[model samples]
Target: MAILIYTQNYDGKFKKSVFELVTYGAAVAKELGTEVTAVTTGKLDTETLKELGKYGAEKIITITNEELNDFSAQAYAYAIEQVAKKINADLIIFGNNPYGRAIAPRLSVKLNAGLAAGVTALPSSVSPFTVKKRVFSGKAFADVVIKSETKIITLNQNSYKVEENPVDISTEEFTAEIPEGAYAVKPIETVKSSGKMSVTDAEILVSGGRGLKGPENWGMIEEMAEILGAGTSCSRPVSDLDWRPHEEHVGQTGKVVAPNLYIAIGISGAIQHLAGVNGSKVMVVINTDPEAPFFEAADYGIIGDAFEVVPKLNEAFKKFKAEN
Candidate 1:
């Protein structure tokens, strides 16, 4: 009745963010005494689209335009603005990803709506609309109220537990014709990372930094992560020197991830990096220097040389899993 959620289909498949945002939008809609509508942009799998119904999107609206195949910020914003107005949707939500960040603001400007980026918690109903969001890199938070008729928000990734429902759902195809727009931005070379799970999307992450001593030692990092069924990432400097793929880099100016378990090997935690990973559920820091900054923020901290320590840790973990 009141809200809309814009879902970005990655490679025609829904992401964790899609399920999470839809669940959250549904909850808010329930509270507001309104139903939530989910809008999808670009090509999508029919089977995957059918799954979104369980998340409580009363109806699903999908827009298919080849122009939107590769994210053109202007085109996406234009399409969403058209869809929202067509439905007269008052509240719109998006996941706080690179694409979301680029498009939400543009849509906000076009719709003349109030937007809150990096929202952490669901909005608490207090007469007028108010949302709680992280400020100052999770050090603080603020509750913002949007009095505008239209409200736009980008929910923080991995903040909400994914809720699954097994039920039949309805899908509606939206035939909103695209309008010609000024092409201000040109398509650049799309350089994609080679792996499946990035640190942000990984269930478990094994990370390293300068503590590895050199890129030559990164093999140990890879070996351990491979053995444990985890992805690999590094601090900003590691990516700077090309020791790791840019997509695997974690921290401010990089990807922010909140995986179930995060293992930091031989990396000193800087405030910038911690800001990105503070959302991780469990963090284990392995470092030779006892005073390495990461220990202070870790759930478990080990002061030992990573070269000697990591092999022992892996062996112990293997044995425990075997025995159990």
Candidate 2:
């Protein structure tokens, strides 16, 4: 039996989350007294694939099917299922991102394996595989037990620390036999954001709410994000009003993020909003209302006008950066 990790790449390059998944998979393999085999698809060089070995992938397999150039959940799931069967993988792992969310359920059904998504830790017991995960929008925790012989799990982003445990690695190329209908729904075009840190990947985020007043005033928010080397985000209402793109929205119905630091300007903390960002390590709220709900959830709060507070805070950050 082997542990298999599905490492997703963007534009033929692996991201930090891929390394984290590999590291987590390696730890799980050690726990189960097995070895880890990572699988991916796309046109990536051998040197680029070798990096997975630094985090405990004993072998890396790349699916070189030209039809898989664009992501289709059904096609990707079928490819991974084939790989798992070929390697006799008992435990399959994926990062709890969009790809994992879409593909894990289908793969689980196809493999007839029990699945646990948003897993936050390693199995407490191998005899009856159990995992802890956040539920109720990060407001509570649940320990789920998977009883299937072959199991699948999607690890929550940033929940497990990334560690290096090097091992000698080998690579292989597999071309999956995808049927004709697999590409029933193919992407016609893909537009990628250029020269900006993705909110989901950012360690630090400067997010604005309706308190920023208007889209015209977003220059200060952009300035703050640039000064801090952080990503810019906005609340649901701000996005709804077209002050920012919907992609920048974060909340219950928007993107869920767990950054190291999240700065909220002019946002009153609603439960829906908090549910999405409460995973942040540290939250700072700056608002004019002393009783703003965000203050209750913030690690630090400044009860003053954002217009006055933001400029001063930006200057302070600049000074701090210059000095140190």
Against the true structure, whose TM-score is highest? 2
Q: Note the Cα lDDT for every prediction shown.
A: 0.84, 0.92
**RMSD, model 1, all Cα superposed?**
1.9
Q: Which tens-of-lDDT digit does each residue in 1-324 have in candidate 2? A: 699999998888999999999999999888888999999998889888889999999999999998888888999988999999999999999899999998999999999999999898888878788999889998998999998989999998877888999999999999998888887896888787765888899889999999888999999899999999999999999999999988899998999998889999999999999999998999999999998999999999999999999999999999998998
Name the lDDT value of residue 217 in candidate 1: 89
> Cα lDDT for residue 89, model 2?
92
Q: Model 2, which residues run further than 4 Å from truth?
A: none
